[model samples]
Target chain A: MNINLTLIGQSITFAVFVWFCMKFIWPHIVHALDVRRKAIADGLAAAERGKHEQELAAKRATETLHDSKVKAAEIIAQAEKRAVQIIEEAKATAKAEGDRQLAAAQAEIEQAAHRAREQLRSQVAALVLAGAEKVLRREVDAKAHADLLEAISKEI
Target chain B: MAGEAHTSAEYIKHHLQNLVYGQHPDGTWGLAHSAAEAKAMGFWAIHLDTLGMSVLLGVVFLYFFRKAAIRATSGVPGGLQNFVEWVVEFIDGSVKGSFTGRNPLVAPLALTIFIWIFLLNLMDLVPIDWIPGLMGALGLPYFKLVPTTDPNATFGMAIGVFILILYYSVKMKGVGGFFGELAFQPFGKWGMPANLLLEGVNLIAKPVSLALRLFGNLYAGEMIFILIALMFSGGAVMFLTGGVLQWAWAVFHVLIITLQAFIFMTLTIVYLDMAHQEHH
Candidate 1:
């Protein structure tokens, strides 16, 4: 169509479009973009913080592990010390018991020896008296017999 | 135009020109077109075009950020709250570097300007004929959906920025100061006649360049698409070949649109910065 009126309308319409865009429309889109940018930066910051936290946690875990190992070592050392003390105490007690047993055995041996010796001496004396009784006759004169016996005994 | 092909090109170009004021008898442009109609329509939908998308996106962001911002704590941040803060800070940095003084209104305004323009520019990535063809199939005759492709739209924005720069210049540097800048800044102190001529040219060039940059890029993009369409409309062989070419170009065009939007936003900052500078 050869209509110029449409062109006129279009020109007016376009100018208004520009005005609307500059005044109102542009700000909103910019705000959205601005939001996008901020989101990216925040994400980076959060990631950094997370990394730091993780590093800290790892450090704490290592320290705790080291502490536990040291404590275990200390406990083992203490047990070893206690074991040595117990062994020393047991050794002392055994030595003392052996000494007491040796003393008791010696005392029993001495008593037995004394009893045997006495019995032997008694037996000997009885035998000698019996021999004298057999040799002498009954109802003899005591003084005469005694003097004879003494003289014979001195000569032999 | 002897060839049918040449006639078609002419036809398309004719159709693409703005419906400014009134036309000549032979469908050429008249000397004095109505500025009132041009002023009114040029700024209307262009404003709505940017505003509509901005508000929608803003509401979505606000809803999401509100939830995030509320949940924010000094302890640890995750999910959406972290995301929102990241975006806010990034844009804050960009604005800080580009804009000198902290005007509460200007920062947010610049942010809006960037994103809205970005979204608008992104629309170019869609297949040139896709929406129009779909609408046609749905019984709608024609659709010129791209906002930036319209010169009126780009110029309108440029003009708006131009006005603001002028206002700020006047405010920052008084009337004498504003005039003094054009007279002596570009060239050293010369006679009044030469100074006046140079100043007038410099003064007019700002809005012209701003408007033309956006217009030229978008217009060129639109023309390429129209050319591709013409190829397909001719025959089946041309259609298939042109279709492949169109797809390839569309993919490549994504970078163009994004770059254009970024350039426009950055330029806006630069221009505003210039206005704020103290004259030597």
Candidate 2:
């Protein structure tokens, strides 16, 4: 019941205990807590950044796909246009070739017709001469009958 | 065996007395003395039982906590680690809530006070006769096991807190501000004397209340246990009732012990917080 030196002794003990706790015990625990908190925060931020980058990558991927599709369509369109031009050129060439061949055949036919007409005319004249010779006697004067022959040829 | 011829009053008196070490009335130093002899030794004497028990419990507190602290990890904790973390978090939260200014020492100081006092008070739950009986067998007559039951121990702790409060007040507010706080108050500078007297009492009352609250609760609880033990002598029916009463009281005293420790710790933080604050 009496206040005594025990108070001082216990106070010293209390002070020592407090000093121990303050110096050794408190800092480590609090630092651990702070470290854990920081770790969680950093992890969350990294996850968020990863998600954002993933989204951006996805968007870029889609854009690239669209660009490739458009490029492929353009290439196909160019190929189709080139194919149409080739077909048109081929048609024009074939038409020109056919016309040239027709012209040549026409010329050949014309030449042949001319030759046949000439031959027909020569044969008719020869036949007429022979007929005249058969009708007239052989002693008639040939040089004097030249004008008659020429007239006859002209008549024929 | 000593109770064979003595009255119940003497038994209770014997149980309440501490194993004191002090000077004799003949001016000789001795190991043990009567309570009256301890009083006559005049504030120079020590209660060997209280000091021993308190220091032992303090060591127990330090050892267990230090072990837990060493093994403490940032990862998922084991049962002991979890318990230690929970206690640390609890005290840290209490200091944070009650203490406004930031001092690295406050949280740990609060933790030490709470746990150390809790350990000291827990000795009360030991069957009141167990240690004394054992020590009595070892030829030691008187021993008080619970340190907080002694006014000296509680006052000792409270006085330590009181010193911290004064230190913080002077450190934070300066010496002039500290005195100014005591000298000026609810009435104004015109009532400086009244303010000084009132605030001085208020300041003194903090530690006094802290000490007495714990000491009174535990001492009363110890007395009741002694009384209950005394009840065992009144035959079979009395002994049975006393047994039931002891069980009931022990159960109730658990809350008292823990609550008193918490109150003491909280008040310490609050007082320190008050010192840290500057009120113009």
Candidate 3:
């Protein structure tokens, strides 16, 4: 076939079409793809950061759990030691109270015994003086015997 | 298509002719009813079928792409948009791979050449008679729907690329640098004439080969299709054979058309890349 005006016609059509494509189609489509690409990249980055932060939180939680456990053990040990010391102090107080009460009771009993003994000695001396006066009144002078009896009573 | 009414050679010749419009020697401008009249129309004649069909296909391609472009979104894509974006990405990748230049025009140019040429070549798969017979029934003398089979369309597009190549060459390298590339290449300055001969041929051969290669392949393929279609005029066995052969060739031609389009686009990018490259 002979080449004719169609060649020029087709060239003009092609130029116009390419101009339209460059202006409208190519930039819009490529820009959409680029935006989607950037969106995917940003989404992936945020996900990675979230994973890192979660790991940090997990590690912090474990460390805090370990610290709490140690503090709980320390508190338990202190409570046990305080309980032992309280028990020891109670035992010492009870023993001292018993000793002081025993000492006071012993002193009171000795005092009572001494008073009873003094009363008994006075009674016995009075009874012995009465008996000696009854026997010596029949045998000797009363005045000389009275002095001896008085000295014996004072000794008693 | 009453194939039996005409002789086999007449059928074949009829299918091969274009709907030409030009002035007659008698000073009237109209369609050529016969091959002799089409031939007599000479350089001023226009192949309306090739022009109309190619422009129609181009419009179809542009309409779908423009629809997709108007609503193109980064969030999600519909079926048409996905298909369009897929093709755009493929052409973009081809450009990025072969072209190292920064011209905004090159990629779109590659895309246009690829899709438009592909759309033009796709008409080869149409049953040889559908559109032409329809047009013939409508009182048109002849119609050839596939544009890539015409050298006019191919050379027209190739010349467009050639113009761009020349432009970027002068723009990237100076006009003198562009001439220097043609004058003193593959040999020293002492061999400038020989170098100009060799390099000039090389330079001009880019568009010529690009045009002829596509035109030749599609023309030959269209010719084979026409030849196979002739068997449909024979009796039942030949008709069945023709159908099977037509199917097989069409299936194979799918690869050919796609490959030709890809080659055209790739080579355009490469030639443009060469234009953009500065000499070390």
Candidate 4:
């Protein structure tokens, strides 16, 4: 083939194409790729962060559960202590009430025993007077004997 | 195009000749009908076939790419956009690997050279006689479809790269530095003539080899196809053999065309890279 002016025409066409491509085509596509790369990177980073936050929230929930458990144990311990104290106080009140009732009963029984002994002593004195009269075979002065009998009853 | 009356040599010559439009010996402007008349038109004539096919392919290349560029997104890509991006990425990767310079033009120029040359070379697989047969029916004198077969088009592109190489070498390293490189490289100033002779040839050979390698490969490939086509005009046995041989050569030619385009683009990037390197 002979070299001719076609070389220049082809050269002109070649230059125009390269110019058009450089001006219009390359930057947009490259920019799109760059942007897509950045988006993927950002998405991965966000996912990592979200995973970390989820772990933190789970930890916080467990910690709150532990705190509530400890608090519940303390409240139960206090309730058990208050119940024991109330039981002890009731025992003390019952013992005091029993002691007061026993004292009142004992005082009444003593008074009753004293009254019965006085009655028995008075009866015994009367029987001695009657036996002495039988031994003397005569009725003594009754009014003078009464005072002595009363004194003997008091001694008994 | 050759009629059915042409002999084998005439068919081969007809297929090899370009449809040139230029001045005749009478100083009149018209299309050349004969190869001798085309030669007489000399350096002023242009090959209309090469020019038209190249520009058409270039336009097709640009239109599709321009559409892709206009709709390119960081989002999900459509099929056309995906294909366009894939090709652009291939070019970009080659450039990034081969070129360390920060010039924006290198990548796009590489893209243009690769795709445009590949498209031109792809014309070789068009069955050798389709377009010319069509043009023959319409009464055109000559039609060489594959532009890479034309030395003018290959040199056109190669010389364009050569111009850029020369421009950048001078721009990056001042005129004095560039001249000094040619005059002092591979040997000291003591061997200035030898060094200049060596480096100058090295410099000029970049474009020459680039142009010739592509032109030679496709030219030879086209010549083989033309020869096989001549076989079709023989007996039925020759016609079947020609068909099989044509298919085989065309299948193998696909690799050659793609490789030549890749080589051309690679060499261009390398030469431009060399140009942008300062002499340390």
| Candidate that would win on DockQ | 4
- Report every candidate's CA lDDT: 0.61, 0.88, 0.91, 0.92
- Model 3, B135-207: lDDT tens per residue? 9889998999899998999999999999999999999999999999888777979999999999989989999
Clashes of each: 38, 0, 0, 0
DockQ of each two-chain model: 0.04, 0.50, 0.58, 0.66
Question: Which structure is stronger by DockQ: 1 or 3?
Answer: 3
Q: Is the docking of candidate 2 incorrect, acceptable, medium or high quality?
A: medium
Better candidate by lDDT, 1 or 2: 2
**Residue pair clashes in candidate 2:** none
lDDT, candidate 1, A109-147, per-residue tens: 888888887776656555554465466657555566778
Q: Write the per-residue lDDT of candidate 4 for residues A1-156, one digit (tens) a residue.
A: 899999999999999999999999888888887888899999999999999999999999999999999999999999999999999999999999999999999998998999999888778877875676576445556566767756765675
Model 1 regions lying over 4 Å from their true place: A1-96, A115-156, B1-14, B17-150, B170-180, B183-200, B217-260
Residue-level lDDT for A83 in candidate 3:
93
Candidate 3 vs candidate 4: the lDDT winner is: 4
Against the true structure, what is each candidate's TM-score? 0.54, 0.80, 0.87, 0.84
Instruction: Specify the CAPRI tier of model 1.
Output: incorrect
Writing each residue's lDDT as its tens digit, candidate 4 over B1-280 gives 4467887789899899999999998999999999999999999999999999999999999999999989988889899999988998899999999999899999999999999999999999998889998987888989999999999999999989999999999999989999999998788989999999999899999999999999999999999998888888788999999999999999999999999999999999999999999886
- Which window of 10 residues has the lowest lDDT sum in candidate 4 chain B? B1-10
The regions of model 2 sitting more than 4 angstroms off are A62-156, B1-6, B26-28, B33-37, B233-240
Q: Give the best candidate by TM-score.
A: 3
Candidate 2 residues B49-85, lDDT tens each? 9999988988888887777778777777778767878
Rank the candidate models, highest TM-score first. Answer: 3, 4, 2, 1
Instruction: Name the weakest run of 10 consecutive residues (lDDT summed) in model 2 chain B.
Output: B30-39
